[model samples]
Target: MIMKAIQKYSVVLLLLFIAVSIAGCGNQKEESSAYSIFYINKDITKIVKQPYEPVADITDTNAMIDEFLGQLKTDPEDVEYKRVIPKDVTVLDYSVEGELLTLYFDKHYSSVEPVEEALVRAAIVRTMVQIDGVECLTFYVGDAPLSDQSGNPIGVMTNDSFIENPGEQINSIQTATLVLYFADEEGSGLIQETQEVHYSSNISMEKLVMEHLLEGPKSEHAKSAIPEGTKLMSVSVLEGVCYVSLDESFLNQDYNVEEPVVIYSIVNSLSEISTISKVQISVNGDTSGVYRDSFALDKIYERNLDYVDAEVQGNVIEEGATEELE
Candidate 1:
């Protein structure tokens, strides 16, 4: 969500302003007095942090933000580290609401390569949220907010958003093969597809599964079982049951897909994981209510092949049972 726009200032003024405000925190002679300025390695493969000391102190919140952005756009003294912000990209405007800072950039920001863009984002977010009162940040291109390639909103990100090792390793890559379920062309039956994925090891397997599920199906005849614009808030597994928490948008089901189809689509896909035997879905973590007419958000669901089309099962479903299953 965007707020009122704030005027931009020169880098020097921003740095000076931040120095004065931060100096108020305590003694400037302390050895521990420094904040980490995140930068991309020269290879653009990972993000690294450099120590930065404030000269004075910062009293203004906007100045602190400007200072961090200025540091991000400026190249570090070490040639090994590169500036996170590309020359083509510029922060056109910005806004602040509570602890959330929203940066509105020019259209050029969208042109960044996906891999480098993620690194750049990690650097920016890791640096900005360091401000005393700012806890999270989000991005906007012109009037539109940023969305992942899958079209889900990136939403608010904090230090916990990016996985970083204790010392340096950040945004490390890992691979996994997933068996995901999607809706058929009719949007009334479940179809299973096996997919190989290369992702950040920083992300958990369950979260990765949900991300791919939200991205929709890659098969020609398959369709997405989940609702468009549904945001996965959180997901985890405990005692063989995977608990999937999503935003309220999940409640806005598309009419083309049946309720049970949508429900089992998640249930079966998550159950594909060896550790997950059952699945429980909740809206914003509140399972007190039901989904639609008969499906309960609090209910624990087990994989049911009954909804799988008989064509793929080769007569596993008894004749004329498809209608009954739906």
Candidate 2:
């Protein structure tokens, strides 16, 4: 009887050891899926990240993103960390294309203070990009991509877009030489001009080019091609195509600038960037219609020197458009 009892005890020990080993394996799986969720500090100056592990087995990318967004809106147990999404702001929806994730928020999102807004963007981008497939994110207030008070689109944002500074480093100054195209004296041809500009580092190069074009040409020989009060809704480059979206104001054409001149002005200017090979302009994300009568907004445009004035090629342009000609 004692021998039988001893054998039974040995069997129980083996079973217990197997259970413990299975539990250890489960914990390891959870750790592999763990990621950091970022939140703003109570002072609203910067963001803090906290490691989070999901309670359930969530292998779907959409489900994982949804879980992360829910966490961002939830108040952390730690008093030092605050919820990044403002109470008034509501994430209406989200979608993912390739590696880009876009979050659509209600109009109230625009009400976030500039400094706090920068932190919020940083928190979201840093948190979301941790997902296995997502690499970048953008916020959309209603149909328009998020913009600053000056009406320039914030464009696509990645982990490097914001610096963690209490004072908000989004306004940090950086300089770039912009190659811009404007109409000639007759408003029938493109005249390229170069400008050295000090702009916010947060702004993308594509949006910067559009902003300067809207601001008009600084040279005496060049004229404004974009219509007045045209707000750039958004600008982004993917697969060699620069996608440009503008407000309805862009449809209000300056008749003095011929159709091709106005269209190619934007195309040739943006094409100066090595990454951009084609440009597609749209009004409020609608590319179905034409810009005027001939230039279709739906069509993708390559750099067209056909409308560029011959004089522009020979003139010393400070090396902006001239280099692209070569």
Candidate 3:
């Protein structure tokens, strides 16, 4: 009877040990998951996070990077999102120092077309920066740094480097000197103001100047020539001519300002850029209309300083003229 009781107790203990071992294995599997992956969208314009069970031990930066790059080579159909990296491109290696992550790829990385090159870099940089502790990124093919179509170094990139509009890669802060034209307090003539503006590279200087013109003048002596609520549809410079397209609000005559002042305000301001010699104004991309009765919107105009306020300078010149006559 004593032997039978001991044997029964031993059987119970073995069964309990087996059950606990299975539970331990389950817990270990759950704890290994640590990360998720991101991939580029179909347009090659944006990054999309992949839906997957968290990866295990992603704290290893090198292994994490390798896994991310490996996903980029997956077929679009095989994955939920499209991959931006060309299949021919391979990651040579990667290194991390503080917040900066440097990625070296094979020569195929630079072989992308000029237009797609920026997009590729944007997709890669954007996806990589999503990782924790990665604040800046740089790309290289072998020992040489990657460059854009214009041969400018791709440079270190941050989260703000890629802009949605224009899809261009630029620094977060770029300084430009803009010569803007606004109306005088009396609304009789235009006034020229030189301002130093800091803007993102993703935006063109012409667009920035147009936006500032709509914001009105900082000085109390100057006023806005653009009508209130005027929407700038687009602004671009090509072959030394700047094209400015505005919404219907620009046609409203409620401002009580002369048509030429409004017309020349845009013309002179955009023409200030050395590359833009003239400006063509349009309403909603239609250049067939006219402003008031005399100013033709269909025609391109050069910078006209005739409507500018020259009273102060005129007074100085008049005083000199009087002295000369005397």
Give the TM-scores of the predictions, in the order they appear: 0.63, 0.67, 0.49
lDDT of 3: 0.65
lDDT per residue for candidate 3 within 91-202, as digits (tens), equals 8888997767898988887676543455566666655655666666778887987754323344455544444544442223456888888887777788777678766555
Query: What is the C-alpha lDDT profile of model 2 across 140-184, one tens digit per residue?
Result: 999997766555566556664443434644345556999888899
Highest lDDT: which candidate? 2
RMSD versus native structure for model 3: 25.4
Measured by TM-score, how close is model 3 to the native structure?
0.49
- Roughly what TM-score does model 1 have, to 2 decimal places? 0.63
C-alpha lDDT of residue 41 in model 2: 90
lDDT of 1 by residue, 84-126 (tens): 9999999998898777689999999989877678788888977
Residue 8 shift from truth in candidate 2, angstroms: 79
lDDT of each: 0.73, 0.74, 0.65
lDDT of 2: 0.74
